[model samples]
Target: MEYCSLIQLKTTMMNNFLTLFIAAFVFISCAKEKDPIIGNPGLAAQGEWSIPLNRILDGGPGKDGIPALDEPIFVSPQEATYLDDDELVIGHSSAQESKAYSHLVMNWHEIANDWFGQEPVAVIYCPLTGTATGWHRKLNNQVTTFGVSGLLYNANVIPYDRNTDSNWSQLTLECVNGELIGTRPEMVNLLETSWSTWKTFFPDTEVLSTETGFDRSYGVYPYGSYRTSEGLIFQVKDSDDRLHPKERVHSIISGDYVKAYRFSNFPETAAGIILDNVEGQNVVVIGSQTQNFIVSFFEKQINDEVLTFSLPSDDLYTNGNFTSSVILTDQFGNNWNAFGYAVTGPNEGDQLTPTMGIMGYWFPWTSFYTTVDIYGEQ
Candidate 1:
């Protein structure tokens, strides 16, 4: 599983370009012209190499070999017997339709391409990095699909778009190879929480069914020991020991600035919220340590008045039917859910704008944002 030697091999290949070219020419001459190359040949010359070419190793699967779920099937929460209550899921809602992509299913396929109303998107989860993100599939007016490139960068997944065969770094959110090098895709907010929390909040939610066309174990994790182990299977260009290599964190990035909040640092037992100014914009993070979940949103504004937030106190709800689940209350006394929707009070139908962020391991987040500021550290 160790791939550190690949870096040395790549260096040797680059140093002896004439020999490599002669070998490639001889092999191509013997092969049929009709045979297609596995990846874009132009990619080798494009984009800044974050790491040496040789370090990007094949992850035991070929292009689209991991199979993204294009036409996914779903079952209601009550009927989703495949999921354990504590299992992780990525929840997305659009036009009143809620869908849950179980870690059980994503652990194998890694990516699911589907439509939320008319908006086409790809739900991507990288087990190695503990990252889940939603990507808008439309690029330059054309709807595209993503598949596992079977490549790894910084020990994280690299997905390639079928429209242009360009390899994209999931952590960097940019195309590193092919014709679309340096391009970035629009990101959508995806709520990462436990299956129980999601089901409790969205009882009518549709859970991804195990009846996907591919034949594989649906509820079982394929990567044994990797999830809990400290060692990495692939090589990365840099490393940081500021935090545990695999410690999970919620990170917010704006331009080149990044701020990370470790789950352990946030009071798990208290009903409180963290408010901070990131990149000059007000941001709030709320979560329950007991429930094992966290969510963040940008502060709301009305009539040019920026609103501040606080957790609801028992005295504020003495006459109302509020519960501990209602974690956020704005200065205007509006109660909001974890997803930032106002369940009651003056802003009943209004929803706070969810900030762009990711829940991932410290290693990959720091590798991409080396100078990231960690909350609570001077």
Candidate 2:
């Protein structure tokens, strides 16, 4: 290399320094763009965070990375052969229609934006937490869609609404962060049971089809062994050992009170019915071991008559179909189905108001409601 004058050398050194500085600046900018935290600025600013923001890990998928089903397709139950007989499903019904969303499909996409009758709804399922529930998607009569926020609270999914960008805790059933903090979405009753049981209940129901616009192996479980494993993937601050951490339970929340009933607590052979006082409200829980189904409804009084229920005996007339009907007899010998509808008896055509409840794993229920009361306990 030729030697240069002092002034010329100084100028050359300055140029090299500027080049290095520009390269460093570009490198830092690109690095931040790749950061999950920096990529989600709206989520970063979410207020009233229940857990430490740093604890919310990138669940391998970014926001909307696991796409939500917006315009879901459906087919008759006969066409849903991909689902195993014992595989779980979320079932919902309105006055006009009944639908089933198989766990096989929900295992990949946790949220499905659909409608029940004329009312918009979001069917949400968290495989990690073993929770499946439905929420009214309309806020102040305006429709909103939800997506996976790539965040977890107590190992449960946190869904964010596309309209307000508000992050909601699936277990808590309320907006925990962003613009709609503390807002609770109206809940619709959803039944979680085996595919076989659901089909038995609603043979003519429509099933969510795998034609979800996204390319995902709907037959394969995305979380792998996590579903069967007892250990949690993320940290949860609270727990209760009354039931197995992964044991499934049917939970009901009313006002500030919550209660959970495990499958083990139900009678093994026949149908069992229990009336419990929850938050001063009389709630009736009905379970069928043979059917593998449990549901709760508020005790209703018609014409100042309080209805108490019991499992219908074998002799009761069940529309000539005892195997398929979940018949319950009141003190007056009126027959009712699991849905609290008086099908045949003196009270025929009457309806028992259904209470909004959920079926989920024990750990997540306890993690969200630490003080939840367990049925049959003091």
Q: What are the TM-scores, per candidate, against the unseen true structure?
A: 0.82, 0.82
Score each candidate by Cα lDDT. Answer: 0.78, 0.78
Error of 1 at 96 (Å): 1.0
How many residue pairs collide in each prediction?
0, 0
**What C-alpha root-mean-square deviation, in Å, does candidate 2 show against the real structure?**
10.8
- What is candidate 2's lDDT per residue for 243-340, written digit by digit as tens? 77777778888765679886666767666677888888889988765667778999888668898777777664343323444457888767876566
Candidate 1 lDDT by residue in tens digits, 4-83? 68888887888799788988777665433433224334336656554457547677777788898989999988789989
Q: In model 2, how many backbone clashes occur? A: 0
* Candidate 2 backbone collisions, by pair: none
Scored by lDDT, model 1 comes in at 0.78
Candidate 2's displacement at residue 336, Å, is: 3.1
All candidates: CA RMSD in angstroms? 10.5, 10.8
